[model samples]
Target: MTLDGFAARPLGFVGPLDLSWRDRSAAVEVVGQRITAEVTAIDLDQGLARLSMAATEDSELWAYLKPLRVGATLSGRVVSIERFGVFVALDDGPDHPVHPGVGFITIPELSWRHVERASDVVQVGQRVSCEFLQFDTWQGEARLSLRAAQPDEVPPQPKRL
Candidate 1:
């Protein structure tokens, strides 16, 4: 495609594609043609954009992991632990472009028991299995639940006299 002798790529029917710093580049297949975009800001020093391609590719990290659905079981190494969650680098997929891992286990999902700190349930380098919860649309990461992968601990029963 060309406009005034300049190459023009069609964005297609996909809804509003908002580009942010988080989205450095992306590619979509439209009508059997692969269209790739590299989003940059206008000023180079300030990281602004005048619409130029830094690089182009047919797919991204998320594309490979797309087949995974909610409730699927996954195993990964606990790469990092934050106050909010534990980041897991999935054993079955590529590393996330921006985040530490494709899988994230939130504090509440880290354990069936009450958790005061994320570290109480998981640690860095711990290999854990988790249940896929959902794909976090904003972060483009998979949400997971370690607690769901483990059997609930049975409490002791009182003795009958």
Candidate 2:
């Protein structure tokens, strides 16, 4: 329940709570009511709660992704094309909670050579293998590099007359 524009959760010891941002919301249940909750950390600026729902349940995607070290290769389909980057839905993981897919490849990371456009390297519906770089904490997405998955093409040299 939300009180005074803030989300509130019942705490046994504290009773009706009156805490501020970053406070942990207690997980409590009332019989016969939809009282399912996971402890959540509040983000005041985003007006969102970061809940760990996977803790109570098994998440196959999390299970697969959690143990993947950086630089691991993963395959996915290009779900969307953007000027900034491409979003890929990984074949081995579940759909991302927020973005179109769990994987994102930036424009610069898409190719070894100069990329005039994102479409030049990858198109929508294309199957791509990318190297895992890091997790984007803010967006809860995986940062990948398509260029790293391919061999570098040698640049042409000027001919001496």
Best by lDDT: 2
What tens-digit string does per-residue lDDT give for candidate 1 at 61-139? 5465556788899998999999888999988677676788878889989888889999887789999999998866446
Candidate 2: misplaced stretches above 4 Å?
1-64, 154-161
lDDT for predicted candidate 1 compared with the true structure? 0.67
Q: Which window of 10 residues has the lowest lDDT sum in candidate 2?
A: 12-21
> Candidate 1: misplaced stretches above 4 Å?
1-58, 154-161
lDDT of each: 0.67, 0.68
TM-score of each: 0.62, 0.59
